[model samples]
Target: MLKPQMSPTRELISLDGLWAFDIERDSRPQAWTGTLDSGLEAAVPASYNDLFVDSAIRDHVGWAWYQRKVCVPRRWTSDRIFLRVDAATHEGRVYVNDSFVGQHIGGYTPFEMDITDLVAPGEEFRLTIGVNNELTNITIPPGSITVAQDGRRQQKYLHDFYNYAGLSRSVWLYSAPQQRVEDITVVTDIEGTTGVVTYDVQASAPSTVRVRALDASGTQVAEAEGAAGTLRIEAANLWKPGAAYLYNLVAEIVDNGEVIDSYTQTFGVRTVEVRGAEFLINGEPFYFTGFGKHEDSPVRGKGHDDAYLVHDFQLLEWVGANSFRTSHYPYAEEVMDFADRHGIVVIDETAAVGLNLAVQGGLAGGATTPTFSPETFNDDTQAAHAQAIRELIARDKNHPSVVMWCIANEPSSNEEGAREYFAPLVELTRTLDPTRPVTYAVVMFATFKNDRIADLFDVMCLNRYYGWYVATGDLATAETYLKGELQGWVDKFGKPIMMAEYGADTLPGLHSVWDMPWTEEYQADYLDMNHRVFDSIPSFVGEQVWNFADFQTSNGIHRVDGNRKGVFTRDRKPKSAAHALRTRWRGLENQKPGTSN
Candidate 1:
């Protein structure tokens, strides 16, 4: 039996109480400074739509103010107090005790502000946060239309998910010692049959670095030394997925022979690369058989506990999946850590969604027409996009399970100057970390046309929703159409391709062909068709279904409750299609070349 995984330490500060809120109209700088009595109770981290049923939080475009009071602990004062916001929609300005702290301009990336200077030990301080998501603001992306305050028209992107805007992830206050480990990077290099592991360490201060490699028995197999930088160790004990061999890397930041901070990261020494459309891991050909996953749970939204994440991982492992894609956005850091321990390959993505296609019009006096044309290509918009990418990479670059850095997921193919927008971002990722591959999910024909930036990526991924999105008649017809679309890119780009996302949405627990395409039966049949296509196509690398679990969607169209394309329900119950995929991927593990299991 495998040892139970240890959970990371966490403390959540409740923001779900009474808060003073005020909506601002058209202001030059969009500032909120006045203090007001708390009138209504709004849950922290919950969307404004969930609390105020009548408030036009979703379609309305302007500034919203949220104010609350928080008490700091006396012990926490000795260490540095950091206020972390996991996610805030659009743009935000944070203030502690009327003192400006910092500002962040992205909806999906995490940001932190040092509030130690602004707070008094064991004293209560008023916290104020102002958010502006106005559509007409040239700094922010424009919607399909611009509506008036009384609800007219505005510009917005046209999309298929709901826009539940607020602090969607979490807010927390944590204390770290002055000289703590800031970040870590683990890299595995394999030459012939020998494996070499190197660790790039970062610290808050100058400290001695002690590195140790341990085996399953807790015996030290290798040891090396360096100070506050890169440390290397060579060993023959490499790890493979099924073989389950793993090594523990312990790094100690020492100050005058006293340990100031220490961090232990578990990593397996293995190398992975794509060769002629086949993924070779540890010098052996491997295929990525998995699903795309969202962080949201049914009633919990994005507030699900660690048990939920672990339960989903257990289900994925049970179904014989070896890979997963963080569809649309980046997942929490702990989720990637779990993947590393379980030996699952992860494609870490930045938090960029349907910005190019969200409805442009507002509810009041904004524009009327929905614009699918890209508006995320502007200089300011591009800077905001790049910031999100950089934050994601900074937070997750250390995880060993992550094999690919995904820039975007199915951005608008018809957007103006898309190549100009994405080419530089791809280059930026390569500059940051050249060890891992960079990829973006593309639509069939629309994205492949631009070969100028196509050569920038190591692997090309296509988000093909053929049997579901288009009326391809049947699975065979869908397969034929998809192959024809991908063939051009494979020939022209000379890179391995992955069917990044492909799945059909269906109502859970509902069965029958009468419900045809929208029923569970249809979903299973769709997976069967996808498996056949993946198994037969030699030019394609592998496939990841549209989702691993049902998640919240804000699009006014298609996904009302959530995107119902998951192979598992939001609560982590398996759907029929999940088992069908297991049969195919597991069977592949036993089959030899030219032989079917």
Candidate 2:
């Protein structure tokens, strides 16, 4: 929660490079099997499913073991050390030298375990991590590990992305002071030309905390005292959409005139508000025009790749966009940091996707995407869902890039007792940080009349698919129908709304005579229609395409090679729709007062 930076008193070591990995159907013991190199070798912070040539390993729905050897440095004897696993697929179990350390359930967030006594200075230890990518009904992204009559195991999920499982993020060892900073929460606002930053610092022990705000040149602009306080910056260089200027802040914990722990965090001076169906950033409505993207690529799967992160933003910038939603799951911390420095609005969503059981269970009667539902919102599932929300907010609350917190994406909101399920979740998010707005991405099947959870949101985010899913190949009828749906949302609530997901499945080089579906021509025309309808609606505040690019997903009959709804291809090549987006967004980018109230 400390925004993941180098600790002044902490010694950091990268446990990346190569790791011993093996795939197994059953749980393996902690004992070392002879030569780990002779077995299948894979890189750390990557997906094993895409590493091998055999389809069996790619589709294996059971446990995979990752082992490594680590020795603590003797120079840091008095510091408290911990093993930090950034992510471990769906479920993870950690062990240090045949002794069980701890376990974490969710896969997308960072989890750390204290191994101070278990590991000694200059002593080597076997660090075994058992990761299971098996998805059950209770998992946040619901899917099943089903075996056929021939004993062939397969991974089945409702989401439209491949189940790439492994250590998708970095793993490292870090040392901290005996008493150090545990977490920091920051909330900022601007009054006229002055910037106000209010923060709360939590430490392991009681100590005097000193806070300093520095400009881009690293010169101190303001200072404050105490564990919780505010710091003001005069004539603050405001963080805007295109030109994002950031200021650095350092929080130090001192004990008896000794600096025990220090942390440096960066933030932007900005404000977000919703006033009478207008989404305002920095006291005015900021038009959002971007896409809902996934952490996906060619060979790396969902693994965090620096090259893909940099290229994807370039595509977004080329399209003249300003915002995006971490649709279906929370992205890595590095993505948030990039958005902070580059000035992009983010709707940080939780991994509570695939909760709509009706669509997957044939109860919805339409061919909709699958939802992650445990069927009923009972104790264990609810607690896991709630904990994900808490950790997401805790880790991302200090980021100036995050404008809103999307609690879920396409959950079973219209089901019975759905209000009881999400009300507490919304209230919990508000309790954690009351500064940002809270909302979720509603699926296309959700209706305004029977919508059980839309009232709990500050902004109405609807994933409408009028031209593609409902009307199919007809853009004429889809245009009229789409306008009706947009008007229905505004008439029902009159709240600020965003078109979270919209686009058609388009295949590159697939030509059509008259703009048929699946052709690149149809994609551009489909988005053109949606844009035409959105520009006429006054209450519509934003339009986020369904996907920035095509990505991998489970093999199915309907999916040709995965969902082809991207403006760009899987390799980041632009389809025809990419030009349509650029042509429209470029004009909007130069306009002031994004939304006319």
Candidate 3:
């Protein structure tokens, strides 16, 4: 799952631009026919939903085709070419010049096809990619589709976010040598003044491996000669919050002292752990101050935009924040890379949202059903969930910014069969990567008293809306209830607690003198109340607000345009709550553990 990069022994090309787009209305199987017949064109590397004015296009449920004719470089004749799709929403199928090459399930993670035998260099071929936006009971983020009398398939799910689907990430055409480095796994550690990097390289053939660690200035600090060995640096510069320092690890496969393959991996030397009532980074307690963010913006929907990404990180830094959670799904790799370079801590999560049937029923006033019933999220769902965990760990295991792995968000931890469902997943995460802690965000219904899976996690990540959802604008009672609930958590389990989500939906410029929900003043006041309770609890280690910005959601009466819980608007304009957070977080920017600003 190594990201495609340009190196001395590798060639890269971006297959990003306008592509022939058309909808597949019938459920019948369709094969690639070299070119799409439809006249509609859509941009690659973006969600096709918001780019069109047609509602049918925006709400497309089944398969869609994106075809682009590309030319392979003649110089890549001796190399094995690859077609790497950074991401395909839910499912994707690849075709080379008219024949199917490969397919992959799971939306957020990357998948590639080695198409060396399918196409020839110095020639043009029609590259077609079919993307499906369907989700069923067995999918990671489970959903259902029901056909109406008019034969229209409507999608229903437990999550509140919109199903903006397409190839929202980059597509790459890269070349690698026949005997190239296949994969590399790196684990970092710090010992007093020395930085330790232990690496394992997987190559295609038996070759001499040489590893070099270079500082930010491109000077070699350490070198080792092995496929698996450690590079120790004296007086190492540690990667800290707000002060990121990266050391590039260059791994090479040498044949008779001549390099045959080379790849560079940028990594930060850091360590994460959970000890009693504290979440420590680099052997020191680190407090988190940020928000639960989404890959959302105006027009782009869930598309990955470089401008939006840079601006969002700037805003996070401007607000004096150091961390954020990839709320419900794994975001684009570019987002993760930015976080790594900028020293932003991340709670990397899977798309295991909407697993709770009760939450969906509550949100829509529907009949509640057992979440883990035979007809619902059962064995097949568990298998899909397990696969999601495997892919997530394989993709993001080496990221220094990812301090924790959030397996699921807002699952029905209080329901029956909850323990059986998540217990093994938690154990699986630890078995895969024993470096960091594992957690799942707790819904408001899954309290400390009734939650069955909280004990399995290392940190208790609670997403509660005390004043908004429970007390309904009653700040005083909200504060009291919040404190009591948090105290119950501390008394029940002496683990460190983090407020993974807490916010009031506030419309921009909507001012009210009194404590009213949806008003700017109320959102600010609600956060203040929650902060007071967090400070009162000894186990509280972090506070990530519900959202970083307003985002699109499915059509519902509860949502106006979309979720307004963001401290900033969808266009990156700050709401009043943003200023309030800035003032508070600025003071707590350097606050030590167990101390108030």
Candidate 4:
């Protein structure tokens, strides 16, 4: 399947801004008629969860409908028109003018529907979408909805993050040529000073897919014509961390020497491998130094905010970080494209969190049952989990910034059905794209001895809160346990290892002795101890901190206001740990803002 590409010829109409919204506790209509009865309006690219003043409406876990009107351009009559939903959370059922269009079940990826015949050109049409945030065992990021003692419905799940829902992305009407280039798959390799770019483009019809590689100045450097071929770039500048240089690959659909449709995507000439105990980028050992981040904010919740996005990038630059993981889900495509321009390494992840089967173990303010809870062993949950992996790869496969594909974040690898659950998923990810390495973040509770699938990945990704979760404010004990645990992984797997997550919850301005917990000094000491242990291990390749910034989580005693594990506060202000990280990471010249080795 090919991903739709953008072009100068393809026209787009923004269906953003205000939209009529309403919530229903009972079942919503399968097909709505005439004018919608939605009573309230909301900003399209924002979360409805945080939009209302009433907490009942804010936390409602049932069906919510979004209705908006869009006019198809009169000029697009001759073109192939389609509707692109950037994202709709959890499960979504869409309709246009009282007619069912399509339904999509994932929250973090883009899905499109052809509405060429549904709407006449130049006429306005009603667009309605019903979104359900209720997570069952069959959903990827699974959870349950229960009525609380206060007569309010709330979600109970595995992940530590909040369940913010609604039309969390953007909606658009776009026009493309009938025989446009559908998808482009690019694979790059640097040999000596030369670069080899192999690409396969899928088109709508039998047309010559003219592929061109353009330099940074938009000048053509290399080109080829056919469905699949290679173009050699002479004296090619390598794309590296910090020095991320990009070349544009443009595909044009030409018939009888007349240009019909075209699409362009960015690619970096680089390669990554997890070879012999070292993680290599461009064939040199590379160490990842950054944080594992979530797309979260104050009022916006997990909604996309461009201002916050740009600010986060600038902060990463200031603090000397060269990479980050999209922790529990694939973020907006805009964020991935930005990484391409900036040379930041990204470990793109799927929203496969909370698949644990254990019925016990709840943190300070959370309930006990796992995400994809009791029924996690069933076939439906596994299918949904696999589908999420497929969607994530298909959407993000073309990005050069995506050096790896993370199958899941902290799944149950130690439970009774662990192997049967993740084996097929791991196989699916590898079969989809073998160019990138694949791994899942291993939770500490799923120790090396108990994890049946520990050696299944190309690299071992460990998320440990040794001092915070175990030893509790004792750095010496934390250091010893961390070393022993890491050594056990090495002795068993012998693969390149990374600390996918490691942090302590610390409140800003909260000061105490370094031995105390939840204080600035304690967080810094805990991280320092972990770093020391990592340096001593030869197979240790990367250390992406637990979080980039403090973020809001569902309320609990474990958190003060929210999770305080960020190096920077929720407002992007640097904490004591952020400064400490900058000082240590700066000394390693290869890890400077623009390069990694």
lDDT of 3 by residue, 368-398 (tens): 6888888999989999999999999989988
Cα lDDT, all candidates: 0.67, 0.83, 0.90, 0.83
- Candidate 3, residue 390: Cα displacement in angstroms equals 1.3
TM-score of each: 0.82, 0.95, 0.98, 0.95
Q: Which residue pairs does candidate 2 place in steric collision?
A: 354-371, 354-372, 355-371, 355-372
TM-score, prediction 4? 0.95
Preferred candidate (TM-score higher): 1 or 3: 3
Is candidate 1 or 3 superior in lDDT? 3
Best of the two (1, 4) by TM-score: 4
Reference-based lDDT, residue 378, model 2:
57
Q: Estimate, for each residue in 1-597, the C-alpha lDDT of model 2 and write its tens digit.
A: 664456668788879877888877444453334334437777888888888898877888777888889989987799888888888888888888867888888888889989998999888888888788988767777666777999887777767788889988888888888888888777888988999999888888888999899999999999998999999999999888777899988889997888999988888888888888998889978778898998888778888888888998998888887889997788888898899888888899998887766666443535343332345445566778899998898788877779899988887777666787788889999998888999998877787877888988999988888778788899999999888888988999989988999989998999988958999888988998998898888878899998998999888787878888989999999998999889888887666355221
Q: List the residue pairs that clash in candidate 3.
A: none
Summarize candidate 4's per-residue lDDT along 294-386 as a digit string, tens digits: 888888888888899899999888887889999889998889988988888999999988776452463231324433334444678888889
Model 4 ranges with Cα > 4 A deviation: 1-6, 148-152, 362-374, 590-597
Model 2 misplaced regions, further than 4 Å: 26-38, 361-377, 592-597
Report model 3's TM-score to 2 decimal places. 0.98
